[model samples]
Target: MNSHLLNGHYQILKLLNDREDGKTYLVEDVNFPDSQFIVKQLRPPSSNPQTLTILRRLFASKAATLEKLGQKNDKIQKLIAYFEENEEFYIVQEFISGNPLTDEIIQGQPLSEDQVITLLLEILEILVIVHSYGVIHRDIKPANIIRRESDKKLALVNVGTFNEAITNTVDNLEYMPIEQVNGNLKYNSDIYALGMVAIAALKGLPAKEISNLRSQKNQLTGEIVWDNKNLKVNRKLAKIINRMVRFDYRKRYQYATEVLNDLKKLINVEDDQQKQHHKKLLLVLTGVVGCIILGVGAWQLRSPKPGSDAELKLYQEGVNKYDAGNYEGAVEDFNQAIKLDPQNALAYNKRGDAYYRLGDYEQAQADSSQALLLNPQDANAYFDRGFAFSQLGKYKEAIADYNQAIKLNSKNGYAYYGRGLALAQLKDNKGAIRDFSKAIALKPRYTEAYLQRGIVRRRLKLRQAAIQDFDTVIKIDPSDAKAYYQRGLTQSINKQKYVALKDYTEAININPKYIEAYLNRGDLYSDLGDNVEATENYNTILKIDPKFIPAYIHRAIHRFSFGNYQGAIEDYTTALKLDPNNITAYNNRGNAYLELGNKKAANQDYSQAIAINPNNALAYYNRGVIRSKQKNKQGAIADFQKAAKLFQQQGEQDSYQDAQKEIAILQHNLAPAPTTRPKSNNY
Candidate 1:
């Protein structure tokens, strides 16, 4: 507690922090006045006996490894000296002058994407060296990463050691075999700890609770919860982190070198993007120079240059109109430009964009192809051609052209976003997400990228994240009916019926012709038992799209709830007529027929429903009821027994009990009648 020497040499200056494992103190070396150091006490007597022994052994081994590691990398903090006093061991190590990464993240100043990638790659390199020496950093987390203030160089601290605060605690201890525990103190455990550290850094939260993270029901994979808003991570980097932090160890990168390789690839990608941007700028500058030369040549050759100048003016006007979203007017001006200057590649590209906007794929493709023929290096022409291909559902060709456009101009966010959409159509979710993220990196306000990324996230079952993306989309474009509709669907999946209904209603308000919204809203109403509103919405959908199967299904349910058995049967029958494999319709129709005393028709419908879906337990129950009513007591009992078994298999205890009751009733009814008729006949 004083500014005095401890254990013969370390001059204790001030206490930094203390944990269950040991205490950290700012200290100075007695041998060198200018030398500063940190003294860490390992396995203080206050720790548990078992943990003390483990730490004593671990530290003795780590000290030897650290001595060797220090010689390999100057950044590796040197263990200067060590000694023991009063049953507590202290280690003197080089004092790092910097703040912990933990403080930065906790203070709401997370590292940028570039900084994160660099830090991770450096740590991975250090880890590869440590592992090669048969040492592992069993506890890897933000607190162990130190950023030097003067050089801005990040160094991994406290390597080849466990954070006794985590592993030395006896409470809630998970016992492992001695061999496994020892193995866990080696490289495999180091990999696990590194993954946890990566996740914590990217998500700005502790990764120890990753097992409890929500996933789709029955899914073995855990969802990655990267706080991109907080960390400012690009999509590509987030993906790399996700793969690293996989809950299943087998799915994660087996070695630190593999993770480092991925980081190197990302670095290369960033470099390539920069080079492409430079090339595009050079090309644009060349185009400007060419235009100036052409202007000079025309000025020298023409006696009257009015007509040529007018053509150039009209072409510029057409480009402006196209940029302003006036596709029809842009097309008109483009025609005039072509009449004045038929060989203008810029005019052709602008006209192609206009045609693409008008949904004229053939004309768009022709004009874009012409533009490309005239100027093969034109990025805009490639983009236009890609758009046309995407419109025609030729995703492969669209992707190829988009690749070409990106090669010519990597800063073209539009091309990246378009390629993302095409990839999504092809069901390449990871690729699509990467492209969308790149688009977002280039254009922060890109609503379409957010919307498309949200859809892909939902497909990946990252529901909460998908909701956030949709929220961003709605914030950007308030009248986006599809955004509202998709958000409502996500809410419904999350089982928030009222919230889903509100979203669906908003969608309908934005675009009344959104038939899916009407149907979905009706379904939500039906789920909430608002049959009247459900029926009204269903009716609206049917009026809009007469062949809508869901509307018929909902109307049938509404009728069934209101005791309109015949009407319910008619509606269900109509739904099934439109779609023969509509199992729900068949089941509902069977129930309606059973209520209306049509036993034969009810049985047939139930059989068809069962044929469509072998797991339709309700159909079995309905058939059992029909058999009971027909006085075939033995057959009734058999059917009820089967129904009860099926219900039990499905974990429907109440339905199983109902079937059991029917079985009991049928068995009782099948008992022999009393024999008392002989006396009356004799009289």
Candidate 2:
């Protein structure tokens, strides 16, 4: 126990901290210099060897879970290694270099409302992932949140469910909701703690002080007294925070995503600027600004807010269905709403959003365009159309529409977000980053903007910077499987194959239908010569989606590499069936048949490929070899000559030379070969 080295590997450098659950140390791997890792000594409650052994195994399993969660996200601390030594469990994890958020929060310097929103969004995003794993972080406080120095983003440390102490009384009672103290903890308990954190930061007071201040007021009242504290928060955000910390658990946000969505809405241009920024200006310059405001309202009134009661009910139902993730039901309800209220431009815009979610970009574009025609000043409609155009790969058109949306409502962060996506598609990475940064500045919790910016940064070869952006995205929405998959790709590029594999596996676990993750993992396995695993992944893709052409082609290539000629031929044939004019499929299938010594079949496939694209030099070369093997000397000579010419024209010098050699052999075989040999020896 007194040895500096643990298990003959980790050399203790310094003690980080100690708690009731475990003692943490910053350690260095004796095997890996210039590497730092966190080591925790987990002490079992019982001193019995058997109990300790059982706990070690359980701890190992938990380590795997922690590793998976960490790989799928950047905000979570990554478990690197774990082992049992001296009847005590030792867990190693990656060290994050950052200061605690508590340290960043000064007593007299409360964070701005925007900063509060950003902080809550970041924490809620991580909580969503944590809760999905059925793990409750009973300790939600500023100290647990680290302002990571690498990216200046928030990273949640020491996810609590890994330790039994989390279920006990929380170390910081000030952050604990009343229900949790009563031993009735739920997901909303975390929400309550986050709300308290927000209030504490805004009030520039300790959580205990704020709670004590609130406890003196009427507990039965539904109104939050903090709202009356004259804290600098918008009404909408205040309403959300109030609901989050409500005395009644049922009144709090039921889920982290619910809180996140409301926080995003609070920063929306329509909600923030229209209501908060211009309120006093509109009152003071009522005559001038009122007309502009009236025009905006009139555009909205094209749908008539007081329309047929039944129609309005249907529209509200559609909105509710959309919010509940029932896109198909929402579409039906929206259709009914449109039928009942034909002049509803808002209905058209909402329906367009529904279509966009369903991946029907054409229909979405049409609906959004119709809405714009009905109300030319509708920024939401323009934004919707821009999103549709971006999805359709018409980046320039999308950029134009986004420009119009931004012109109409300059404060629209989402329009900036849409424009950034289009600019990214247009190959303007710098422009895309600018717009994305702007969007993030205006809407601090804009997860998609962070994601797209990460992609652009990765494309620009800013690996660490890109990773930081992806980390922010994960911190904003942990359930985003795409973010994990993308981070896996970046890790793979960085030569962290093992870490990348864990990331891809986590992504697949989160979304079993994620074909791209499977395909990428299969490709990585194939590159590493783990053909069995690669084939299994490809098989899984086929099972999930038999019509997926890439799976068939990739599987065929894998089979061909392993000398499974017939299997490769069958897979390539399936690919050809899915895409009749697939040139690569025909050529590859022909090569597979040639490998199996089927000259006739191989010749037919080569001929089909050449017919599809006459300039295919490989097809010509392949057909020439088949003819030469068939003993058809005249046909072989003719085909070889044609192949040699085509290969030369295609700048394939080696292929051309090989074809020329075949032609000379065919000609000599057709003529009298013995006579030519004798003449060459004499010369």
Candidate 3:
């Protein structure tokens, strides 16, 4: 193509790529020489008149929708102008300049998991806008994503037009089944392609190669497996992708809006893990690497070349011993190496690694610090130091070392993952997720990443998405009892009691000694009104761990429900013994005493509970009842009024109303004495 003007204003510059529907070209505007654009020349499909018209209508409808949607999100490339020239339709859009995610992966210099997640979130936000306008991108792959050179953020391009144009041909349509061949035409199809892109980024493989791994008969299963293994980024992310790419359209996400919501949740989870991992990596890099560098420098400056070589040799031997799990031998060899070559960084690093294995974090940190001083650029030294720092709970220093390690080697997924763990310890969820995502991008089969990300997601209140992540964990490691337990907890919170029970049972079956599972299952049983089952579960937990206070409390509540006041009191007392500040136990015990007609005991218990937690309106009401029974009408009225005020403050109208009723009764009984009382006093 010539560099001359085309369509009056667009001057052809260079061809970018050719697609089934059109040729994409980089062009400059004749009127504005500095402006650049991507001009797509659409070739109308040669088909019957009826089919051609339908395709044209679809294209026009999609184009119009895109124009409306483009105004909402800045992440999408905007279409500028469209016109018909020589019977061929052409559309001009903003030209985005940057490398594709595919290119980055192929160059073996892919972005961190955090970066990938950030980009995906940006795209997802754009999808939300596009889908809201009843338009699907229909194709979303790495090639369609561009990283802006100026901001380093991602943008979506080459969307909404080409798929319809290419698939509109009558002859091609007759041979290709819409459901089988045109599966990529729907919104979820785009999501499927995006998942493939994510998998490719994680595994450093092409998307088509992963697709080929799926058996024709069990395509969805293969996708799930590959996505789970490669993106071990998080369980929640994998599940979201799995849902989006479901073979059954009905089972897939019905709208891009749903996918967007899921993407936000996944982003949050991954971000938290990323931050924690970054911190741990920092600590290791600084402490371990610093020590190794210092030790190495000291060894190199030692007198006698022979002695230095011998020391180096001894250090290497020590490292080998450490690698072989002979920690004692390794320590002996490292000491000899240090004696001969006092500044051997490698020797220090090896010794530190050994100490770490031996659960001597302090010694490990000391050795790692010496190593880092000897070789500032040593990534391994930094990593070891950070690990020691994290083990010692020196999280801030650990994070700093991880940052240095990442600066030296961006592909260090372990460092990022470690940092995420550290950040999580500090309750920096957002930062942790970011580091976790980076780790996932670097090493997709990182099962720990998924587990951590799922936990963070749950913390962020993304319950449904968190459940999806737990499901991924289960798929990756079927024997993961913790995953099952966590998923059960989330399901229970979401009110899926049956599903929660099943997950809890699975967890208990896998690890029969899981006390938490038994306790949670007991709570679930109680929620379902299965008192017998609930009591049995509580008893089971008590058998395993008798000191479990929550179990005692639950059992007490169950006893009280069954009118076993004495048993309830006994259980409540035991619970209080286990945990002295158990206000619930005090309150429940007071109820039991009241039922037993021990007004004084009931009053004392209620007063104690109220003293412990002044905001306990129920305790006040109960105490008021006791006072009324004891004929302290004024005291009872005061307590009832306070209870009503407290209930009203808590937004409990029903409880407030009940308190008011009691207050009214007390007021009627304490009504002013008639004037005859004065006459009696005078007499």
Candidate 4:
């Protein structure tokens, strides 16, 4: 083949380089004689038509993507054309008249930290656009980067990955990451090569010599150890470089933006902070100055460190804010205090209290536990932890912590109140009432204690006494939304529907965004068969918070009740995807599936509910019915027995009897029992 005018309208000026994948050449477009272009020849090993066909398609697609990128980014080389000549694919690219970066990155001459940082910023600017398009530039070496002659701005060349050529002595392989070399190119692979280039420049090592200069290498983990201490680079910059070139791609910066952000932080923020500013005084001084120095020396020996005053001030400010009921502001002050002095137990405890007030129970528990770690005997911290546990439904743990708090400080009325709430959740109604009474006795105006005792009273079916307790709480704080909500629940249970509706409305008026109030009001409307009102309430919940899964579930139940099985199935499926372990979603979705005559899908859902929670007796019973219908007699009997045992253990007398009846039917090998109805985790 002639090197001149190899294609109909192109001429090869000179061969630029050779590699395993293909050859790149300096070429000129014969039609546009005033301009020159770079042409890349794709050399596939196999001459088979099928192999070449796939390669040609991939080549054209990559060329199109590069053209798109070049249109948006001036730094990237523009795609001129791509064509097939003699069964070989060639990509023509716009030529940049410039000096290669290899000229600046000379061996035996290390670039300074500032210079390397600047270089990184320039390269990363191009990469941000490249990576955003989900395209990985497999080749990012010094020779591939060009400092344009007209302007000093660097221009990127060879943007496609098809130029991958991994050979023992190949210069490209020096900068190519292990993942890229193995043909699994990640977005970070380009970052890794760019990092390697920076490392080589900073170490005064050539591409070939850089590989040999590894002081330590973990072959298993693929950690590359370059000398940061011996070089003049900033330690922060060095760490960034190391992270970019980690052996495992997972450990590397997953995005160009991430690496760029870290580099920017290191350059912009840490650079100025690297120096310490202080005043130096002369030793030559008068008697007064000497006395002052001696006094300061003694104070330094006895007083807290320089930053202790600031920490104490912040803690005091946090306490003041907490007293003012500004929980958010208190949290901000406590955060600063903690940052100033992490070992301050008081600050952590105060922050925990603020978090508790904000209803962040998990964070409250964490901070209170940290406070306890610093000072285990602190009764307030113990009470805080107990309160968080109670809110999170860890009733036993809450009780245990409350026990500790009471032991440490017998006058801790809040501890007793917290323990009462936990005992109420555990269904120990009498114990909860007793604890609440003790709390009220300790603090005569303990309104929360009265409120919680009311709840326990209602659980025990002491309706009049529960109402009296709620009346007392209202007397103490007439504006309490929770007190009204609890009363509404009690009235609803007593069949006072209109009264319950009024109480729910009052709660909502006091706290317009009260989710429980909205839920209960909607439920009452649903019970009354007022479809329009119920729908409005549900829609309001969704509009307020689309991620409120419980509202979707309620709407699904309403749909199922009205015979819209398909709509119910879709809603339940969405809920299940968001909360896979939700027993209500599984059981109800199974119900919807069953009504749709999809017994197979129903059986799968019931099985899943059982898998998530083995003690779910309803799920076991439902699955038993499906198995019996499918004629798996022994399997049905086994499931029924399990359901009966669990139902009996849980004190569900009616359900247990039903399960036992099913077990008898299955054991006798007679006709299957009636299908078990779905259970709900109700409002």
Best by lDDT: 4
RMSD of 1: 20.9
Error of 3 at 20 (Å): 66
User: Which is the leading candidate under TM-score?
Assistant: 2
TM-score of every candidate relative to the true structure: 0.42, 0.58, 0.44, 0.47
- Per-residue lDDT of model 4, residues 1-683, tens digit only: 24667578888888887777678888877788868899888776667989777777777677778888788677888998888878777888899999988898888888888888888888886887676555777779888899999988898988764553211223377787777777677888898899998988887777778667543686676588785466666666788898988878888887666776677656544432231010011111222354586674321111114668888788768766765558999999999988877776667877998899899999999999997775565677788899899889888999999999999889878888888888888888899899999999998878789988988889889988998888787665444668888999999999999999988876665455778888888888988888888777877888888788898799888777778899888878988888888888898888889888899999999999999998888888888888888899888889889988998999999989998888787778778745555455553
* Residues forming the 10-long window of minimal summed lDDT in candidate 3: 674-683
Q: Residues 365-456, candidate 2, lDDT per residue (tens digit)?
A: 99999887766766777888999999999899999999998998899899999899889878999999999999999999887888889889
TM-score for candidate 4, residues paired by index: 0.47
lDDT of each: 0.72, 0.78, 0.72, 0.79
Error of 4 at 299 (Å): 23
True lDDT of residue 369, candidate 1: 91
**Descending-TM-score candidate ranking:** 2, 4, 3, 1
Q: Which stretches of candidate 3 lie above 4 Å from their native place?
A: 1-398, 422-428, 581-584, 603-683
Scored by Cα lDDT, where does model 4 land?
A: 0.79
Model 1 has an lDDT value of: 0.72
**Per-residue lDDT of model 3, residues 413-514, tens digit only:** 989988898898889998998998899889876767877887887888888778877877766555567888999988888899999998898777656678
Runs of candidate 2 with Cα error greater than 4 angstroms are 1-311, 324-342, 358-360, 391-395, 423-445, 453-479, 490-499, 573-583, 611-618, 631-683
Candidate 4 residue spans exceeding 4 A from truth? 1-314, 317-415, 422-428, 441-445, 631-634, 666-683
Q: Lowest summed-lDDT stretch of 10 residues in model 1?
A: 674-683
Candidate 1 stretches greater than 4 Å from native? 1-306, 309-342, 477-481, 509-513, 542-550, 557-565, 568-683
Question: How well does candidate 1 match the true structure in TM-score terms?
Answer: 0.42
CA error at residue 371 for candidate 3, angstroms: 5.6
